[model samples]
Target: MLPKLGTNETMPLQMTVGLTYDLKDDYKDAGLDPETIAELDSPATIDGLEAALRQMGFTVVRIGHIKNLTKRLSNGERWDLVFNICEGLHGVAREAQVPALLEAYQIPCTFSDAAGMALMLDKGLTKLVLQNHDISTAPFAVVRAQADIDGVSLPFPLFAKPLAEGTGKGISPLSRIETHQQLREVCTTLLQKFAQPVLVETYLAGREFTVGLLGTGDRTRVIGIMEIAITDTDGLYGYNNKTDWFDHIQYKLLTLETEPALFKSLCTLSVQAWQALNCRDGGRLDIRCDETGQPCLMEINPLAGLCPGFSDLVVLAEMAGMSYQALIENIVNETLHRYNLPQPRQRHEAA
Candidate 1:
């Protein structure tokens, strides 16, 4: 049995954690565009996570991806908990594939469940849920084809990107459409290139911010808010900007001490959105301001990347004075608390 919290009973075993992820190199020779595999983890990232989990006293097992996991399960293998970050390569429900499988096998995993993952991945679907919950989000439309672009009621000067992509895929300076012709061209290009519906929303002209959050439900709270300032006038913090952020972007950390009203509003809205979507553990919500500077939800990443120095979540955590190991530990502790499992001892404390 797993150890329980608040008890002095000696336990004979440590928790065994299974790690599931998709590596970028796994698909390099598949003749796919770079953006298609942008969300996959680097080998270094998996190695870093394994080292951290071991440092935290958990036996870590590396499970490659959905196919590997399926084979492992067929062999009658299981773990106390799974640290799943598998971003499946197909369908609108790709991100939910691993979690749903684990759910069927009666195994628990970190982060949001299947339903939440599916909803959050599709920008249009997520906005619909946010609208129902009265959360502030930009008006948007999903265009599946050229015919659908004509039906977009949203005004001109809109931004367009793939409906279910992350890591700024299908986004660029041209994403901001100033004319109907531009809109059609951009949407058509994205539709053909990604083979997915496109999401076109009103262009948020003010500043952009991404809030880092932790915990579950009512316990969810903002860890930090980092403003993404683009140095180039035409930059949109899209694929190019994100890929070369050091040269074209500036990250300004915000806090209640610096911007009290804005900070509180962002925190409140972020937590409300997190709960409304039933998201658990830790993640991030991207918010950008309208012309009037009111923050609006752009998208939610329940499975935020964990590539240590490269991921935005880790960068924000460092800005908030949290070490990489501490950020991982906090996520693990929150998951453990949610599952009613005893959290491991802190690395600095006596064993």
Candidate 2:
């Protein structure tokens, strides 16, 4: 039962949610094959969220790609909450821009606000913050230029990826380097190829896991832990492997294969990492077990993927015995609960 606030007072109503999604403005510059871009861009996934919100009795508003969101929000139309899915344009600041826009309007939105998104997007900054909190993350350094790799003390088999990138953009099989020469070559390649700062980290070889968290502060709950079982491939979960490198052996789901008790430990650590970062609403923590089986934090995804079947959170939730419907409903209810909104009256209660 929900705590009673005031019986006579009507619960605040939510209406007309605004959506923001990445439109991929850099199709030509990113060298994204035109066909791939077309496939990626057109499939607007607002339907599931829309149905959920509507079922909760809210009107859904399609705010298609508010480019200058600050100026637009300042125009004075009020919304109860901005259902922020704005992953932003295909740039480094894609995730950061949405909540910044909402903050201007003082409108509460779903997921982590802009500041958290900004902090987590930069891999270097996220690791530093984790280290300060006494979190066990792999040793890492940032290479802004190829020249910056010279002073790195973290030993190889190091993993290198974009410092500010998400969605596994520049990660490839060759990202793991075993020597100084390979590091230089990979760093140079990233500088020339991706045109972004490269994050080099001492790679920890062990089982990989992901944690899904919901709510903030004490209200947070660990939904489940999922392990990334390399059932078929010999390589890491890099771009090529994730995109198309799957073989028959690598096709197994890790959660299904991992011991139930061990996975629970992973779930515990993932939530710990979320708390360490002060993440709000819901998000995901990526973790890996070192050779000794101790969990090492990788990074947090405040805007954890929500693409129904394809998302990591969905997989984690399924493993934990919750259906997709139940997970989405929980997320919506939690967001509403954050503002102290009243829950919908059940038929029995209404009667």
- Scored by TM-score, the top model is 1
Task: For residues 183-232, write the lDDT of model 1, one tens digit per residue.
Answer: 98999999998899999999999889999999998789788999988997
Candidate 2 per-residue lDDT over residues 234-257, each given as its tens digit: 446654444443341132234525
* True-structure Cα RMSD, model 2: 4.6
- Deviation from native of the Cα of residue 149 in model 1, angstroms: 1.4
Once fitted onto the true fold, the runs of candidate 2 whose alpha carbons sit more than 4 angstroms away are 1-7, 12-14, 23-44, 68-75, 244-261, 345-351
For all candidates in order, the CA lDDT equals 0.89, 0.69
Candidate 1 clashing pairs, residues 3+ apart or interchain: none
TM-score of each: 0.95, 0.85
Q: Which 10 consecutive residues of model 2 have the lowest summed lDDT? A: 342-351
